[model samples]
Target: MSAPFVKEIPTLLSLIQCADSLVKNPLTKESPFSVRVAWFDDAAKTQTALLTHYPRLVKESFYTEFEDTVQAGISLLNFQPFWSIMLGVETSQSSAAAESSATMPDSSPIVIPSVAGKDSPPEKSAIR
Candidate 1:
């Protein structure tokens, strides 16, 4: 897949951050599997690395889609100012890279991961 354009880098970065946060703290926490799957669909489209396998997208094909989408969070973390470094994306970053380590066909894909910063507001402020 081609690198994301420089113009879209910041938005991509934000998506990456949100993806990570969602994986750890999903808004879908109380939702059912169907809703979570729909959430994954929407989230994956916003970033390039996840969208790499778009042509293969099948409705309700959850496993491959999950791996590909979640891996995007880990994939681009290998390159910051990601649009620049990802132009020559490392081989390990591809979802296909997980194939070789497969214990069974399409079973347990491995991610070789190798990033930077974020901040959030405090709930309370100090009065001086």
Candidate 2:
């Protein structure tokens, strides 16, 4: 008799743990603003399916709390539950300047909207 196939999906907590490390560690020491993530799923078909569709589930599970934190202007890194699974990361002014110049052409300055006000001057901020 042939053995039945089995698949395993990592729990949300496991994914969160993995994500935590990615966020904590910068892609390069010189570029503390950048993070590297490998978007690969488990080898198992069923597990891969779950990971492929996990973004929605993650949002559904944490959207409310995420919204609250944003409204309060609190850093997601400080939020224990969502720290590892944060959609994005914050950047410092110096890091932003360095990254922008490195990635963009010098023809024109890139205009980024300010959170304080639409008319306010552009400033470095988190990329979420």
Candidate 3:
């Protein structure tokens, strides 16, 4: 009997992890600011292409353009989750900073206007 064929799709988490690494360490051992990130369901396919094209693509200019293209593609993808995670990180960091502060405001007041005041002359602070 023939084996059933399977098709694989890379997970969004894997892509996000790779992007995180690129955003963190955007450098390769051989060159600075030179990183190439590509994904395929079949690693062999990617390996074959890399083996065939690595030499031709090993150059500063090539990496510069490659980086730009890769970054552009990453930018095109929905990175809202990544952005939200980053915002959470910032919020935590700020929370820590706020905790360190000697005085933190408990609450702030809100102003409201009444219908009676709406018909009256405007106050100096209410000038629009």
Candidate 4:
């Protein structure tokens, strides 16, 4: 599959679910700008993310009108648990690692970990 990204899908999707943006993007062309927070541990192995953003540089999305033509060979509802776990990556893959079924929140509030790659933007401490 092509490595196409919807800008900041994970971050924007999460933030869109949360409260309003702390600082809206002034030149917001797409109307959606997000953050990639990083997760780190001191001596205690405690995870944390701090959201910060600044106009970096402009680049083109290879898939401005990307589409998925593949049909669902199977229903994913039964795989929700597994998908939850995969999406969680609770044990490894630092950035691609968070929001497990156990850690997934159901209201209240919680800090989200950064699961992006080392080179990618950090993860935002988000709540949904």
Q: Which parts of model 2 are misplaced by more than 4 Å? A: 1-6, 29-53, 57-128
State the C-alpha lDDT per candidate: 0.40, 0.34, 0.36, 0.25
| Best-matching candidate per lDDT | 1
| Of candidates 4 and 2, the better by lDDT | 2
From the highest lDDT down, the ranking of the candidates is 1, 3, 2, 4
1-128 per-residue lDDT for model 2 (tens digits):
01111112334445444544433432332332222122111112212333343545434434333334332322322333443333322223323444555564444433433336767787753223
For model 3, name the residue pairs that clash: none
TM-score of 4: 0.18
- What are the runs in model 3 whose C-alpha is more than 4 Å off? 1-75, 103-128
Write candidate 1's Cα lDDT for 1-128 as tens digits: 12222222234335445545555544333567676555444454433343543323333334344445545533433312543344334323444444433333333333322222235444432211
> For residues 1-128, what per-residue lDDT tens digits would candidate 4 score against the true structure?
11122222235334332211221211122322232111111100111111211112112121111101000101212323443454345224434333233254344333445557679885654222
Number of the candidate with higher TM-score, 1 or 4: 1
- Model 2 lDDT at residue 6: 12
What's the CA error at residue 9 for candidate 4, in Å? Answer: 18
TM-score winner between candidates 2 and 4: 2
> Candidate 3: TM-score?
0.23
Worst 10 residues of 3 by lDDT: 1-10
